[model samples]
Target: MGQLSRPIPLLLLFGVLVLAGCGALGPGFFADRSPRERVLLLDTPFYAQEDYQCGPAALAMLLAWNDEALSLPALSDQVYSPSLEGSLQPAMVAAARRHGYLVYPLDQPAALFAELAAGHPVLVLQNLGFSRLPRWHYAVVIGHDLARNRIFLHSGRQQAMEISARLFERTWARGGHWGVVVLPPDRLPATAGETPFLAAAAGLEQAGQWSAALLAYQAALERWPGSFGARVGLGNARYALADYELAQRAFRQALLLQPANGAVLNNLALALAAAGQRQEALVVIRQALELDGIWRQELLRTRQKIIADQP
Candidate 1:
């Protein structure tokens, strides 16, 4: 038979390709899809899956992608960042109860990255991985281009960039050390008034409407400056807006009133990290973790980032 006419070997090759990642198919001919879809790609799009994904529009898929042993730290910039204190696992557990998937977090970002390297899927908070990128960062990895050595993720900026998988692995491994809050699938606030503001803040942040959330928190503060809730809201909103100085001030003010408050401290550290004071951020984050026993697990992650940032 002519080599050109051979079909047996080619058929076997196709079968192997089909078996990749449990039948996972690369974009192949669809590699050049629009950036919008690319950024929002998920295991099941808007359905359920055991893959990472953005919110609401990607909830079901996120749930299916949920990793029970997996967790994520609060986005210091995410409005819900405040609610992440005191028991990250339970915190995430509660959140997942309502959102369909728990935002898992590790004690340290580095550990999480190592887990990812070993083939574990996790929800990583910004500052944890890709530290030098920007403040207020958030994203999820729905897929990866292993052969091409690329990592696929849905970024908070709503743009999908095909970053080098090797770059991500190296960067994530080296960096996921700042700090992390393990989130369980169920993290519900036990206090009143905490729910509303955090919900609003998360929504605003998800929509990239930081200005409005910041102002709303300010108005709440005017009526109740001592309200730790309001202050936390302000701090997170400011961080989301990239108002690093202002975020620091907000977190500081909240700390002054609620000294040893985990939310304010970790958030303050987050602000410091954004302001280019990573060491300070580590110190503050440690203080926050110590103040809340639930945060003990986060120490490693926070410490890792600090170490990586050092010259």
Candidate 2:
């Protein structure tokens, strides 16, 4: 509990919780035993937590690594909840997005090591207490030493806190294995799949970050050229930026991947219409109309809009 500074009463409770929480390790640590003697120690920056500000402090570490100039206090104001005395996960994600970073969720414990190996610091949530009696804390995973069976973290009040990998898994599992790797939109997470990577980029789109979303989608396409979602998202991001011709190009490429896909068809038609290819837009929407799916209403709307558009 070196980094986990709490009230005296809570400190005493945490000591008992720690004793009670110790038990057998899960299969997760043993699942991927390869790369047996590897080690990666990132030069990640550290900012010690002030009370319940581990969330912001952890985020600051990641942003600093990315060379973003935001200070710790400013970050605290953005993510901290006065009533909750700490920050929520969603807020942490949103704050990262606001700073133009792609916040990718690391769903598995194995992903933490994978990302660290790839030189990305991972922000993780830990349950420092028992599940029923929870004391939530956030920290950054900067490196791993497999030979010594240790994982390094920038935790509360500790710049280089090391914990056993087995114990780390238990605490992380109790915290729902929640972690994220925050990086610029142009960089991809080491273990991110096509689906989740596209999903994270879509979040930037949803946030109205068209330029950032464009970069993210482009990065996704670079890694996964066959990803229909990346192609569609690239188109959507372009459309938002009023680059109708470029958007149409992306939609057309996406169509090649999955011809007769209603969503892609609708998007392509919309882009065509916006680019003033009204006749071609009408034809595309008509083809989409023949596909039997829930997008029928949406297709008809695009058709109607194209028909009513002035030549």
TM-score of each: 0.36, 0.85
Q: What is the lDDT of residue 116 in candidate 2?
A: 75
- lDDT of candidates 1 onward, in order: 0.44, 0.77
Against the correct fold, how does model 2 do in TM-score?
0.85
User: Per-residue lDDT for 1-311 in model 2, tens only?
Assistant: 01111001111211221101103354347456453355545579889889899999999999999999987898999999989988989889889888888988875656776787788888888898998998889998877666677778899999878888898888888878888989899988888787777777776765667799999999998998887778888888888787888988988898787887777788777777776777887888788888747578777776776676645
Give the residue spans of candidate 1 off by over 4 A.
1-198
Steric collisions counted per model? 42, 1
lDDT of 1 by residue, 95-128 (tens): 4434332122343323433434433344433333
- Model 2 regions lying over 4 Å from their true place: 1-31, 35-42, 307-311
